[model samples]
Target: MATWPNAAIATLMETCGEAVSNAAWNAILNIVFPCPTYLVAPEQRLDSSRPDLTVYIVGENGVFFPFEGKPAKFSWEKLGGEVLGYCIAARPDAFQGYNYGMGGNGPECIICEYDGANMRYLYIHEGELCQSDKMHVLHIFRDAAEILNVLEFVRGAHV
Candidate 1:
């Protein structure tokens, strides 16, 4: 539940000191938190290539949420293959992308155990359901809340 003027989001893009993808993620996180927040990259290996940043959302009891940032792309199936790597990481569970208007259906997230073998899955609902341009800012919040809800569900179930 954070609000940033459209101008601010543009300003963030204009003055980014990191990769476009990472900068987008950082800007969103900045809006989410009041103080300076730094995302810790997950510590795990995936098919030789991983995302630009892996953010950690650790609950009070040590449950970790791996938030991986991905650029919006056209290929959903291909992206799914790449996302499999995140599910394979050495972490409790994982979530990818910041809900930037990358509207077309693609791999949204991978939440799994850190055992290095067992993997569970959660697919973010496509943004197509919401009527608008695929990359609009408002849609980001709507989808992000859904992602967070799923994460909380997984946490509550003790999965």
Candidate 2:
């Protein structure tokens, strides 16, 4: 919709540490959704917790998507809870919601789906959880296309 080439997403995936990653992701996040048609609260609070952002359309009421990002030194143990918190707090209620979220750790990132009825999620794990139990993670170096595919899917799905 924005015609912002998905290939350009490579710039974001290439960032290294926390500050660089956060700023880079923030710039893309601001431009990706654009304006007039969308209302994005970049790096702002969504109720009680905060992700890197909260986003929703201009006329939407009580609906928002929370997004997060991390440096190369990332941990699902800490970030997972935060992402889930953002998802749980921001989801559209009354009828139903997508309950979807995405996060990045430097170039490595994952899209998350939360099944509220089932209380299930696959994007969270730490040393306590068995390595095999964790879902396969996508590395920027190895899964660039896959990552871009997912972003394209997001653009096509909603826009």
* TM-scores for all predictions: 0.42, 0.66
Compare the candidates by TM-score and give the number of the best one: 2
- The residue-by-residue lDDT of candidate 2 on 2-77, one tens digit each, is 3322434545546446666655545554555567756667667678767886666677665455678888658966
lDDT score for residue 151 of model 1: 41
RMSD of 2: 6.7
- Please estimate how well model 1 matches the true structure, expressed as its whole-model Cα lDDT: 0.38
Report how far off residue 19 is in candidate 2 (Å). 2.5
Which parts of model 1 are misplaced by more than 4 Å?
Answer: 1-18, 27-39, 42-48, 57-68, 92-139, 154-159
* Model 1 lDDT per residue over 37-112, tens place: 3233433333465454444444423213334444444354544444445445424333232122111122223333
Q: What does the lDDT come to for candidate 2?
A: 0.56
Q: Give me the displacement of residue 143 in model 2, in angstroms.
A: 3.1
lDDT at 152, model 1? 45
